[model samples]
Target: MTTLPAVSQHNPWTTLGAEVRYENNWIRVVENDVINPAGNPGIYGVVHFKGVAIGVLPIDAEGCVHLVGQYRYSLEAYSWEMPEGGGSPSVSPVEEAKRELREETGLLARQWRELLRIHTSNSICDEHGVIYIAWDMDQTESEPEDTEDLIIIRMPFARVVDLVLDGAITDAMTVAAVLKAQLLAERGQLPEDVAKLMLGR
Candidate 1:
C-alpha cells in the first residue's frame, strides 16, 4: 500500500519587500525580504525567466531519435541532447516544441504528446519547462537562429536511452523525457502505435 503525503494549500513564507537586482533580455533577478517558514527573517534571491523552456524528443518510424549537439556557454562544455529552446508563454507549448524541433533538427512531427512539466531550478530560479514526445515526422531544411551553432544526429532510441543510463546524456529535460517515454512504452501506457514504435516491435 502507498500513503499519499499531505498537501499544503497555504503559503508559509511571507514576503516583506522585493527589489529587482538585475535585468536582461532573457532573465530578471530579484531579491526579496521575507519571513521564513520557521519564523526567521531573511532574504531570498530568485531568477525569473522571460519565457517557458521547451524540449522535444522526436522518435522516427525506424525507432531512432534525433539529437542536437552544441557547446553550452554556461557549462563551458559541449552537450548532445534532444532539441530544446525557449518560447514565449503566450504561445502553446506544443507549437513551441514543433518550432524548436524543426529549427534545431529539421524534423516536423505530426504526432505530439506532452511528457512532463518541470521547474528547472525551484530553489532560486522560476524557470518553467515543458517536454514532449513527437513522432511521424518529415525531414526538411533546418533554420537555426543566428545565435545557434548546432549539429544534428540520429541514433537508435534504445541507444539514446542507454546514453541516458550511462550518464552520457545529462540535460535534465532529455533525461526526464527519455526515461518517462521508455517506462510508458514498457508499461503499455502510451498509445498502441507509439508504444510499438518506441519498443521497436
Candidate 2:
C-alpha cells in the first residue's frame, strides 16, 4: 500500500490561512500565508477546494464498465473519468455517487460498494474524495446537472485494465478505484458482504 508522506516532512511549510481573493462557480483562488520548515515566514499560495468525489469500476449487467468524458475547466480540456461530484450538503457520499452516476451516465446501480477514501490533494487543500464500486446497473434517462455536459461510454471490463495500463485513463481516483476493484475481484471478495447488506440482499 502506498501512503502519503507525513506533512511535516513532505513540505517545509505550515499554513497560517488562505485568504480568498476570488470566487466563482467553477474555481476559487486564495492567497495563503505559511511558515517554512526552516522557520522562515513567507507568503505561499494554494487553491481552496470545495472538495470532490469519485465512483469506482461500475459493472453493468453485461459486465461492462461505464466511463464519462467531460470537460474539466481546470485541465482546460475533456478527459475520460468515472462518475464523480463535489457532494451536496443534503446528501451522503453514497447518495452523491448515485446521483453522479445517473447524471453523468444515465445509469443506476442496484448495489454499491465503497472502495476507499482518498485525499485528492493533501498538500494544501481540504479535499477528500471517496471512491465507490457500483454494480448491477440499469440504464435510465440522464439527469445531468445544469452545469454538466458529459458523454457516456461503456467498455468491456477487461478493457478497463487495458486503458489503465495504456495510460488512457489517468484520473488518480478512478485508477485507484479500478485497481482496488480488480484486486477485490481477484481475491473472490468483490461486491463485499457489506455491499450486499446495503442492498438488503
Candidate 3:
C-alpha cells in the first residue's frame, strides 16, 4: 500500500491573519498572512466553509444516470452537474444528498450507497465533498430552491463515461462519483439487492 504524507508536516507555515476579500452565495475568499519555517513572511489564500458537500450519481431503472442543468452565476452559464448540495450543521451529508436530488430534479432513490469523500481544492478551500451512488430512482415534480432554476436530464451510463472522457463533465466530485460507480459495477462489489434496483440490471 502507498502511504500518504502526514498533514502536520505538509505545510510548515504559521497563519498570521485572514481577511475576507470577497463574499457571495456560492463562495467566499479570504486573504491570509503566514510566516514560513524559514522565518519569511508570506501570503496565502483560503476559503471559509459553512458546510460539507455531497454529490449523488443516481442510476435510474433503465441503467441511465440522472443529471441536472442549472445556471451557475460564477460560471456565467448553464452547466450539467450531478445532484449535489452542502450539509448544514444540523444535517449530515447523506441527508443533504437526498434533499438536493429531490430539490434539483424531483427524483427519489430507493437505495443510496456512499462511494467516496473528496477534498475539493485542498490548496485553498477547507470543504470536503461526499459522493454517493443512488439506485432505483423515481421522478416527480421538481422543487427548486427560491434562487435556483434547474432542468432534469437522464442519459445512458456509457454516455456519462464518454462525457467524462471528453471533458464535458468537469465537476470533480461528480466525475469521481461516476468513476467509482463504474469501478464498483465492474468489480461486482455492488450488493445484489442494489444491483437489482439499478437501471441496467
Candidate 4:
C-alpha cells in the first residue's frame, strides 16, 4: 500500500473582528481586524460591490468596433472604453450586457458570445466583471442614463487594438476584453464568422 500526501485547502487569515465603515447603494466598506497570513495582527479594509460589472465589445459586420468616451468623475479624466455598466444581481448577465449595449451604444446584437470573466480589483474589493463580444448588430437611437454624457465613436477593430496597445484605453474591463478578443481571433478560438470580422479578414 502506498501513502499519499494530504493536500489541505484552508483559510489563512483569522478574523478577530469587523466593522462597517460606510455603505451606499453600490458598495459597502468594511474594516476587518485580523491576524494576517504571516501571523501578524493588522486591519484590512474591503469594499463590497453590490452587482456584477458588465462590459460589451460590439463589433459589426463591417469589421468596425464601437467605443464610448466619457469623463470619469473618479479618475477626473476622459476615458475611452467598451460599453459597460453594473448589472443588477437579480438579472442574467447576458441580459444585462444586452441592456448596457443598447443603452450605451444603441446597438442590439443578434449574436452574443461571452469573452472574459475577471476580478476588477481583488485587493480592495471583490468586484467580479464579465465581458462579452457582440456581433450581427442593429443600430438605433441611444438612451444613455441621465447621469452620463457620452461620446460614441466607430472605428476599425484593429484600430481599437492599437489604442489599447498604445496606452489609450485604460478601463480594466475594456483592456481585458479587447486583448482577449484579439487573442481569440489570432488563435482561431472564436466563431469563424466573428473571428473574420474581428481580424478584419
Clashes of each: 0, 0, 3, 0
lDDT of 2: 0.75
Worst 10 residues of 3 by lDDT: 192-201
lDDT of 2 by residue, 99-141 (tens): 8788778887888778899987776666678888888778899
Q: Put down candidate 4 lDDT per residue, 90-123, tens digits, no spaces.
A: 9999999999999999999999999999999999
lDDT of all predictions: 0.93, 0.75, 0.82, 0.94
Task: Report the number of the highest-lDDT candidate.
Answer: 4
**How many steric clashes does model 3 contain?**
3
RMSD of each: 1.5, 4.8, 2.6, 4.0
User: Which segments of candidate 3 are over 4 A away from where they belong?
Assistant: 1-11, 22-28, 37-39, 193-201
Worst 10 residues of 2 by lDDT: 192-201
Which pairs of residues have clashing backbones in candidate 4? none
Q: After superposition, how far is residue 80 of candidate 1 from its true place, in Å?
A: 1.1
Residue 86, model 4: Cα distance from true site in angstroms? 0.4
